[model samples]
Target: MSDLIELRDRMRAFTEERDWAQFHDPKSLILALVGEVGELAELFQWLPADSAAARVQDEPLRSRVGEEMADVLLYLVRLADVLEIDLGDAAMRKLSGSASRFPPDDVRGQAPEKA
Candidate 1:
């Protein structure tokens, strides 16, 4: 199985073990995801674009950033699991749609048209 699938399964088991499925409805998961994203964003909130990249070189900040990123990913995977969504397939389908909407040759070096 793919790593993401394995990770999703692991997340499912973890949630089941905690009996937390009751708290994992789509709306709650989405809110939790937003919170995680906010935490991740906070890490780079005031940094200049260049400095934001450099900030990851600092071990403590890097660790926090990594944790926040993991939280975001875990919540996303769990949400997908709870919703019975195949994230990999969904991502590919989205990518295909995006490719059709914004063909590389047509959109290269240009901003995408507002949908």
Candidate 2:
């Protein structure tokens, strides 16, 4: 099975074991995902944007960042599964759409146009 599918299954089992499936509706999952993203953002909120990458590489911060990111991914996967959305396919299609909208030869080193 794909890693994403495995992860989704694991998350499902986790929720099921805790009898949390009732609370895993799309809206609640989305809110949980957003809260996780906020936690991740909070870790970098006071850092110099340019140094943020290096800052997260340190030992304690690195572990903290990883945990926050994993939380975000878990909630996102749970949300996608609840919604019956194919996250991998959706990601590929979105990437392709973005590529077509901003061809590299034409838009290199520039911000994407407002859609």
How well is each residue in 1-115 modelled by candidate 1, as lDDT tens digits? 9988999989989989999999999999999999999999998988889788887989999899999999999999989998999999999999898989998888899987673
Q: TM-score for model 1?
A: 0.91
Deviation of model 2 at 16, angstroms: 1.0
Badly placed stretches (over 4 Å) of model 2 are none
Model 1: weakest 10-residue lDDT segment is 106-115
lDDT: worst 10-residue window of model 2 = 106-115
Against the hidden true structure, what lDDT does model 1 obtain?
0.92
lDDT of 2 by residue, 1-115 (tens): 8899999999999999999999998889988999999999999999999999998889899999999999999999999999999998899899999889988898998887673
Pairs that clash in candidate 2: none
